[model samples]
Structures are given as C-alpha cells and as structure tokens.
Target: MDTRRLYSFIKIVDAGSITRAADILHIAQPALSQQLSALEAQFGQQLLIRSKRGVAPTEAGRALYRHAQLILRQVDLAHAAVEVSGRAPAGSVSVGLAPYSMGAALALPLLRSVRERYPDILLHINENFGGVISEAIMTGRMDMAFIYGAGPLRGVQFEPVRSEDLYLIGAPTDGGEAGEVALEELAEVPLLLPSRIHTIRQVVDSAFQQAALRPNVVGEVESALTLVNAVDADLGATVLPWSAARAILDVRALTVRRIAHPVIRVQLSLVTSDSQPLSEPALAVHDLFLELVTAFDKE
Candidate 1:
C-alpha cells in the first residue's frame, strides 16, 4: 500500500471532513476524496461514514488510523537515519514559539548560533500566541515550540525547561514598592493584562481564583509590548517574566518587583508532537536548545 494514501487517510480522520483536510493539504477536494476511496477499495473495507456534519472513521478506519500514524512516523525516522549518515544535517527546521514566552528573547541568539554551527541548515521561526502555537504543533504545522505551562494535550509531549518567577512591573513608585510585592496588593492596583484566552492570563487568573483575590483590570491588552508600555506610563501594573518584558526593562523609569505573599512561576517547556518523527536538522536544533539552557544555568 502507498504511504501517501495512508497519510492522506490520517489527515481526513484528524480534520473530520474531506473538504477541510483538502484545504489544509492544499489539494482539490475531489482528489482528496478519490484518494480516500482508493484506500478503502484497496483494503476492501469501509473506512469512513460521511454525514452532513462531517466525516468520521468507521471501526476499521479507527484501527488503520492508529497503525498509520505509527507507520508514517517510522518511515520518516528511517529517512532521517539516512540523512544523518550522509552528511552534516541540512534542511529547514520550523519552530513555533509564543511571543510572551522565553522564546522571544532567545530567537535572535538561537538563529545566530544555528547559522554559525550549521551553514546549510535553514531555521524558520514562527511567533504566535500560546494557544495558536499548541494547535500548530498538534496539526504538524510546527516541529516544536516553547510554550507556557499547560495540561496534557492529545498527541503532544512537553519536557520542562525551567520555572521562572513572575514579576509585578510598573513605573518607579514613591510608595517604595521595591524588592517584592504581596499578591493582595494587586487587588488594589489596576492591571494591564492579556485577555482570558492567553495561557499566561489563565495561569494568573487561576492563581487569583485560588487565593480569593481579584485584580482591578484596567485594560485587556494582547501585545506584550503594549502591556509593558502601559505600566511604564504609570497607567497600571502588569505581571510577567523578565523575558517577556526585557525591552522595557532597559529604560530607567520602570520598577520590577517579584510577586510574593505566595509566589507564582510559569513553567516553560520544550514541546513536540508525539505523532511525528524529528528530522536530522530538527534534532540538531533540539540539542542546541538543551545546550543553551545548560549555558544559561552557568550565568
């Protein structure tokens, strides 16, 4: 059986509709339907039940889908084995990262290091919000991502990098809010924060929910830079890691205070899809990320 058809079959099952899968695969809908039909014919088993809502896998299709995912990953691993043995790893490695995560600070340095280490390797970085990055990884749009602390996502694996303390950032205050500030203080201080959809916002809200405190939200800003700027202008305070607010920290006008009365730390993790195999170039970059973390520990 041709692996391309098997791959196409898995895509249809994941998408739950031939038209949706075709749009994602960038193939005509009829051609995609034909591929599915041919696969079922070749196997002499009905694979899908298409209805008005969408398509769903039959019992046979469910069994094949499980095996197809494994088979395709193994085939890709075999190809990766050949590529690694041939020469220095070369090809594009696409990584998804959230703008509010540590990835924002590391992107430039990591790109430079990869170029110096592997001249032929092309590194592609896509920055997005945490939820979008997770979806991209699940759908195979990205090889991996550095994302916020999240519960298990289907077909995704997360390896913890480090935990970082969250800080309360604002303009220099005559109130002498220096080293650390209490969580209760945030109840009174107006907050400039991301909306509920973002993972960091979820984390922040959960922490407050548990403590029975509510921050007075002044604005729900999407961009990290805008949140920092609002804090710098003394409009309100914001909570974030140093990595997310590094640009504004350079200015002398801002004050940084670690959250206390109960500390909050966002867990950073290196995430990858379990259904995919890493290519030689992708593996090399994954190793580089670990090395950078080791170096960071020393500093």
Candidate 2:
C-alpha cells in the first residue's frame, strides 16, 4: 500500500480511535475513515472494528500493523542509503569548523589533497564557534569539523589531532618573542579578546581566574584576524591560538609572547557525528585530516 494509507493505518492503531487519529494526523475524520477502508479493501480483510469508544484492530489488522511498521522503516532506510550513495567521494562534503581552530589553516591542506586525490569531492567550509560546529555535525548538515576541546561533547566523537599553547600576543614595541609571560602581566595590560563563547576565550578566562587576575578587556571582536589586527595596531594585546598569532608575528610589526603561568595549551580535535554514517567524500576528508595531523606532529 502507499505510504499515505500505511500512515493512516498506523495513526489509527496508535490513537485507538478514528477521530483521535484524524485530529493528530490533521485529516478529516471521514477522510481517514475512507483511507482505512480503502487499505483494508486492498488487503481483502477486515482491519478494524468500529465501536462507541473508538476503533479496535482485528487479528488481520494487528498482523498488517507489524508488517507496515517494518515496511516504513525499510523505506526510510532505503531513502537514506540512496542519499548517501549519491554523495560519492567526488561529491560535495560540507564541513563546519571553529574560526580559530584548524578548520581554517588545516582545511587548506585537506582541500588540496582532496582536489589532487579525489577531484570530484566538493569542499564547503563554514566558520563558526565550537558549539555551532558541534550542532551542525549532529544535525547532519556538516560532514565533519575541526574544533578545539570543549570538554566532553556528547553525541560527537573526537579524534585528537594536535595541541598548541595559547600565547599572549602584543605589539613588537611592547614585547618581542622574549619568552613566556606571567598571568599578572595580562591583568595589568589592556586586552582585545574574542567572546567568552570561543574555546580559546574560555581557556584564557580560566587561566585568568586561576591566577586571580582580572584582565582589562579593551575590546571584544568575533574573528581571530580582527582580534590580532586590533592587537597589532596596539589597541590591546590578546590571547590567541599560536597558529593564528604565528602568522601575524612574521609581519615584523607584531611580537608573540608565550603565557607562562597557568600555561593554557589547548588540543584541537577532528570531530564527527556518532549517529551519522560518513559519506565517501567525508571519509577521504577525514583521512586528509589525519595526514595533516601527522605532518604537524613531525613539525
């Protein structure tokens, strides 16, 4: 039978009344009754008995109910499998990642590899916060993601890739790459920081809290680039992922200082949904992530 009829039958069975099922299904009671009648007629058996209270299923109805449930489940699986099969290695793979995480720099290497090895794979990358990236993966919108550790994130599996120390960044005039910095130094300095929602921001806040130091947040920007730029212009120094700040320090106009006390080194991870099966493109991308990790480790 068609899905409509099966749905009608199932609703009736679940609601135990034609009227109630019709209300729940948002169909007219008469229409539901007619559909059920048609379904039974198609099967050439009596499926329901009408009564004052509601409708009850017959032996034949019960038997068909079991089969119908399985049929619907199979149909759903078939549709999902077909969708997945359509997404071959050469197909599009949407990825969501934290802005300051490997999602930006490391994504380039992975993209290059995918292009050279699997040209058919389409890479769609979105920059977002860690929580947003996790949500995207869980909802099946993102095939995979690179996010910094947010403790134990449920429903998403983490594959530890690399760790980098969170460094204190300032102008070259203020401090060159002399060495590590004390938390108290940050407390006295004006800080340009990202929102507390960012994983790195949380780390910085925790370090400050541990040292019992309250930093003066001069400004709060969304992107790492903006935060770094603000610091470069001497708006204020900020805590940054080493990878991001290192690129800026090469400019000669900026200097990077390592945070010594309460060393807040954070781990970056490749995360994927535990509930969803990976597409071929997704698997290839995941492999490239591992390769990048290996290369980074060697460095």
Best-performing candidate as measured by lDDT = 1
1-299 per-residue lDDT for model 2 (tens digits) = 58879978988998999999999999998998899989988999999998998888899999888667656654654565566675545566777777766556666777688788878777887889888888777655677888899357777898887788877677343453367777777777788877889888888888778878787888888876676567667888777777766544443556667777667888888888776667666777888778877886577
Worst 10 residues of 1 by lDDT: 244-253
TM-score of 1: 0.78
Root-mean-square deviation per candidate: 4.2, 9.1
Question: Candidate 1 on 1-299: residue-level lDDT in tens?
Answer: 89999999999999999999999899999999899989999889999999999999999999898778767766765776677677898877878877677787778878998999988788999877767887776655677888887558787888889888888887345464568887877778788888888777887888898899887888998776676667767888787887766734453567778888788889888888877867788889999977876776576
**Cα-based TM-score, every candidate:** 0.78, 0.69
Model 1: number of backbone collisions: 0
The alpha-carbon lDDT assigned to residue 292 of candidate 1 equals 76
TM-score of 2: 0.69
* Top TM-score prediction, candidate number: 1
What RMSD value applies to candidate 2? 9.1
